[model samples]
Target: MRFSVHSVSLWLCAIPFLSLVGAQQYVLHHLFDHTNFFDEFSFFSEPDPTRGVQRYVSAFEANAVDLAGFANDAVFLGVDYTTPGPWRRSVRVTSNTAYDSGLFIADIAHMPTSSCGVWPAFWMFGPQWPYDGEIDIIEGVNTQDKNKVTLHTGPGCSITNEGTVASTTLKETNCNAGDAYLGCTQATASNDNYGDGFNDIGGGVYAIQWTDEHISVWFFPRGRIPDNVESDSPDPSAWGPALARFNGGEECHLPDHFKKQSLVFNIALCGEWAGRVWGDNAECSALAPTCDEWVADNPDAFAEAYWLINSVRIFQAHEA
Candidate 1:
């Protein structure tokens, strides 16, 4: 019943070794929630990097303007719909730490709806723009019903849609960021995968697995999230085909293109993509002469634009 001091020390030493073994089978590295989300992320206050008709606010300003806060035990990232603007106020937060490869899972209850002039995204990007890499896990603009998963990288990077679902269309193969910024994109046909439809059913879980060979994204609407993911033993191989899968193939290299990437989330109004395509959308163009004018004048239209996130979990692959 009584163990010697040396024996106890030996057992304590073994504890760490045993834990290391367990950690080798995929362990949860980070858990981001309302309480610690701020500590892990920093609000961006610079001009809209993409020249969108939106102003990124500081943490102090976000709290003051009610753009970012905790509501119902969930972290809320919202845009100011009350303020008409040359500058529409919104929050853009970037993770303080960067990761090379991991399984990133986000449990979202709500996201900004797909409305005219509104472009919202949850993405990851490395420094130096296209040369490093950018992965748009969830991105869409201006009345789009489904999500667009894309990647932007320097030349020599290309992807193939070998493992994606049939309904998903590969828009481009080259991941290079040319003058148009069209990157390799995949369009999902699922009505409930993004925007108003996603929010209507209550937002769901989006999981991104980044590895040396390829990057894959999967979406699980509300009650459909896999048990393996819920339990932290995520096995992407068992998740069926991804909604979007970008394989480096021979022309591109994953490790060379994708470097340390920081997770980012933001909402913008009427810039390059949305503004350029505004005229093509009959419904949106009917509302106003242009995207900027409509967004500036119709503040009340975006009252429902906000993100309600439950948590984000990052897991690293381990070998058992």
Candidate 2:
């Protein structure tokens, strides 16, 4: 979905104490490591919904061109660096299984860094557009050094950023998709949480905890990952404050708006976001007249535009 930024008043509230009933004991439900990632996730060889100037290639096409495969014991999803065409070749993959409330974790060694025409995202969405809901765990466009987390849903869904870290900024509260799908967004304060800065630290782990009451996201650099996260028994309660936290209370109903989400990862080039803001980015606009033109002509500039994922793990609460 297309997103727009607007000036909004900042909202900050105190974090509420969690009761025992709010805590959940989770068990690993699904694991997508390098050995099984290709088998479990399906390549989406369709037109970009965001209108990017990229051709999503099929699994066979990707493998044949070395755009999707294994490298350094991690699953590598990359864009074409040698071909110059109207549309650049890229990859987008979605998990076959849909999930409900759970803890999602992704361990990555590398990801596409900031570039003139690149837009990369790690997100989730339901079957039905807008009405079912969408969550952006990691997303940004050209020259964005920080990560932006957002939520898109149908009418009647507004959220508060009550449990997020103090430095995070909430750009909006209304998540309704009707208003041009702008979605409520929270901008992170750390440069090390995304793009070139993230890769320089050996791209760390991104964890999301989705519950009935709220959704929280956390980022841990290579050396700072929690012990429980490394051991496979994640405890969100002990993780301290989240980087971005969206709370559902009187303003919104969490379960009613979000359900059956499928995980997705993709890198789009010269899309709605990157293209719309091209001129505003002095560094990128100086390279070429337009975003699409730059992406089509400068193939080698995207050599660092790829994803090297170690694993994706999903954990669900054990049934009583």
Error of 1 at 241 (Å): 0.7
lDDT of each: 0.84, 0.87
TM-score between model 2 and native: 0.92
| lDDT score, candidate 2, position 169 | 98
Q: Per-residue lDDT tens digits of candidate 1, residues 1-320?
A: 01111100001111111123543456677878765777787899999867888888998888876788777667788888887777889889999989999999999988888899989999999987877799999888899999999999888887888999999999999988473278899999998989999998988999999998889999999988889877756778889999999997688879998999999989888898888899999999999999989989999888777888899888888776
Which ranges in model 2 have alpha carbons more than 4 Å from their true place?
Answer: 1-23, 177-180
The worst-scoring run of ten residues by lDDT in candidate 1 lies at: 1-10
Q: How many times do residue backbones clash in model 2? A: 0
TM-scores of all predicted structures: 0.92, 0.92
State the lDDT at 27 in candidate 1: 65
Candidate 2: deviation at residue 98, Å? 0.3
Count of clashing residue pairs in every prediction: 0, 0
Candidate 1 lDDT (Cα, 0 to 1): 0.84
